[model samples]
Target: MAGILVYAEVRNGAVRKASLEAVSEAARLTKELGGSVSAVLVGAAPANAGEVLGKAGASEVIALAGPKFTQYSGDGYAAAIHKVAAQMQPTAIFVASTPQGKDLAPQVAVLTHAGVASDCVGFTVAGGKLLAKRPVYAGKATLTVKAAESLLVATLRPNVFAQTDAGAPVAVTTREAGEVSLRAVVKEVLAAVANKLDVTEAPVVVSGGRGMKGPEHWGLLEALATAFGNAAVGASRAVVDAGWRPHDEQVGQTGKTVSPTLYIACGISGAIQHLAGMSSSRVIVAINKDPEAPIFKVADYGIVGDVFEVLPVLTEEVRRLRAAS
Candidate 1:
């Protein structure tokens, strides 16, 4: 039927925002491509998963449940996804450009003999085929790609697409997670901080750089993040390398790429690698003492001041505004 098949990632019995974004994009594309949008849940999905995905525009949801699928096994999950793709033969498969999706997409592509477009930011229909627009060369260039074969596997970048709510409750078909060779199995999944939103998924990111001087100064960034309420704290590569911050908090080409509604860079010099990760942010505000810092080049608003001095005032102002509102 040439329908779009979306891989919906579930974490702690909830649908990940990135997965919802992928389903939403597929739903929009299906309008022009003339097919339905179906989602596949690859783990211990919640019973309401179908309704959640349906609200996100999926017409149907397939749940691959059972003990074997509870823990992530690359080989097992890939085989399961391949099994479904073979049965459905969707023209295009959409997956979120997450750590798991990055590994799963290539394996699925190989099994289905489909070309892959990783970390795609946009999509368009060209000649009845899906064309994916993705950033290349450290986000310096945009490349539009189409699958050579009939099927294409595209990974949609997080926070780049808007998730739309559409359609009614859809039927969810649960299937036993069949047997597959397990090369490596994830024994445990430990989050750095429970209940803390990942920087990639946060609407606002408050990042610190070498200018923070020491780990003790990070409290300023944290205070600011707390003031913003939904903001996540991020660190530059230099800060991570110096061991002042953890690698998970790093935001650069070597770290996690983020496209948030607002990105605040404090004491960051704006290295090209760091810029590559966050240049796509909707609005950027750079705060550095150096007036000549490269971060100013891409910032919508530049503040020339010491972060230590500015952050306290900024945090207080945000608190004041929130209190009044």
Candidate 2:
């Protein structure tokens, strides 16, 4: 009931960026909470993870190492996190709002008898208590909520919180998972195309809608994303419904919510549902033939032009700029 506990997620033996953001935010909150930050890394996290977490503001790193914790099973991961939270007895628990985190937060909350807040974009400490701000009504509005329970668990949206450097590296305390009864087991993980970024995690996302006409024309969108090098290809729900693009790439109310640094909407009319997913993006660029498209309203930059003619020039210009830099 003193410090903040962070569920530091690791992938490929490295900590995910979103988890670091959570830890950094927790560090900032410690001034008001008046306790150290404890980051718990579950499973087969690399040795350097503790150092990385320490630099990211973790006062101490807790390693839950064991064979059962290696692969992520919803039941197993939740059990492990609950055990750590129970032992630490932290005032607040923070988890990244990634796909894994979204599923894990509620389960952990239930185990620890805490109220769970999902996909929070902002936070404030009022009188030594945590207040979470989250998008409600499909991103149409923001609602500030305070958990009635003494222990509060919040899932922070990736890219929403700022990640900053903290103190130097700290000592890592190893812990055992002990015993867990898991109903399901993760035998293996099926990853997407190698090196391809998840839309939710990408820094830049170039999205297409039904205006792309058909799936064959997706190369125009891909070329633009490829030009940026770090950009990911996103699709609107309309295109996914039409089977023009895979559901994984869809960005909308029914799909994945993304808050990348830069979001470029190509040939998208910008339905409210689509806006609900990406309105939180730092900067938005919209391109469409119609000047009055809804996407232009939320866009920081707008290009009223045909996608066919604009995409090639934009791609080449991006490549030229990258080469020059």
Candidate 3:
């Protein structure tokens, strides 16, 4: 029987939000296209990984467990997913638009000779065909692409699709990981100092640019992020290139793209490349001394003041509100 297969990506022992979003999107597709929603869990998934995917609308969970699967191995993961796709004969395969997923999707497509749509923000089924909408030209335009081959593979962008409740647990199936010719393997992973939240996954992000004057002034932005409790710190390419922040903290076309619920830009001029990364944020607040700063054009609220002056007051106010609540 034809079904929809979702690659449920796990990070730091838990399933990634983008993967759940992909599964949720698959669940919706199943309702429209008349098929079952099955998920493949790779890596050292959490004990409740199956339950979590089930709640996200996966009717069947295929757990590929092994020591080699603990860390992300592109060739290994692609091989395992291709094997499952061959056995299940899924009509469409969904993967999240993450670093690992981006690598894995193309490999799976090459193996299956399936048509691929990358970084898709939305999906729809019509006349038994899968179509996807994705950003083009630095998100200035959206292109709707159709799958021409029998098998469809697409990577769903994070935070673009909304997740829905599936209401109950579904069946979980365990499968032994098949052996593949190993050319390369990840021996170890070095983690960075832990932040309260990953910038891509954070609901709220506080980002600063060159307006803060220098790296020494980063404490202001950090304080603001601390006030939000669940917020993550981000930086523009300028700050990152200037050695004021790590590249991981950078948000721009060359850095990580983010679509947080609330994005606060401090001392940023909002270059087009920078805007390309975070313009999709739900609510944007730009603080810059210059009213004509490009950031203000896209900001839902603009504050014309020095970031050093504005940040202290804003951070205190946020702390006060949180305490009151």
Candidate 4:
């Protein structure tokens, strides 16, 4: 019967999907604890942020306005978060487990001396204490934990909680946007690659393991992704470390945890470290020449054959499906 604070992340004039999911999770937590959810943002006042958060199930929206927020400054964002938290005094706080959210939460936690939980899969309040489920040992094991006190901070993995419209009217208010000044400035941000799909936004991902042979043969994976149209190309830790692909494309226990609708594994051996990251996919397809590969155990569909041979057929089939559609 208290208030839980949810952080809203906005970029390119819209709220990020992960931020909405945080609101959704916050809404659920608040409902269980009999508390209201208040959404917080630190940016040039979002045009309709209040209504947007309300639609996403936020009972209240606290906008910390400052032009410096247009671009992410960790210190500024953290300082602003601390300011808002000190004012709201919510029983609990929730933040998305994004790159920025991970970077920003510690400042507030230190200020309030609240226990911080990162990369939590889910949460619940038990015996007046907050309990959380988090991945440990690079995702090999999931541990359930409880915060020492009610003042709590948490981060939720992306793609775990799908975003949906709250469908409720939200009231708007204006506040003084705080200033955060820094000596160093961002020069520029270059895209990973031209026309390359964003790893976080892809619905289907086709990843290559060490069996792909070498970097020169990456064309096979790219062609498959191209055939899928909306699919992104990903790589296993071995493939990335071997210089076959950028590190950003790596998906493993230490890398991004994705829940794509479909995932195609080419030449992957399915190390426990690798499976820990992608086991949550809705559907998994494996292509490996070795029948004994560990990946087949978790795959919904398994094709035992050379990826070099199977990939062309799969790519063609996907292309034909897209063409017919």
- The collision pairs in model 2 are 1-89
Clashes of 1: 0
TM-score, each model? 0.96, 0.97, 0.95, 0.89
Q: How would the candidate models be sorted by TM-score, starting from the highest?
A: 2, 1, 3, 4
Relative to the unseen true structure, what is the C-alpha lDDT of residue 74 in candidate 3, on a scale of 0 to 100? 84
TM-score of 1: 0.96
lDDT of 4 at 79: 72
Report the lDDT tens digits of candidate 4 across residue range 39-60. Answer: 8887665677766788878887
lDDT (10s digit) by residue, model 2, range 236-282 = 99899998988999998899999999999999998899999999999
Runs of candidate 2 exceeding 4 Å displacement: none
Model 2 Cα displacement at 50 (Å)? 1.2
The TM-score, computed over Cα atoms with residue i paired to residue i, of candidate 2 is 0.97
lDDT of each: 0.90, 0.90, 0.87, 0.80
Please tell me which model should have the higher TM-score, number 2 or number 4.
2
* lDDT (Cα) of model 4: 0.80
Q: Give the Cα error of residue 197 in candidate 2, in Å.
A: 1.3
Write model 1 residue lDDT over 1-325, tens digit each, in one string. Answer: 6589999987777888999999988989988898888899877778788787998999989988656776887778878888888888898999998898998899889988899999999999977888999998887899999899999999998999989886677888988767777787789999988998799999999999999899999899999899989999999999999999999989989999999999999999998899989988999999999999999999999999999899999999999998899
**Clashes (N, CA, C under 3 Å) per candidate:** 0, 1, 0, 2
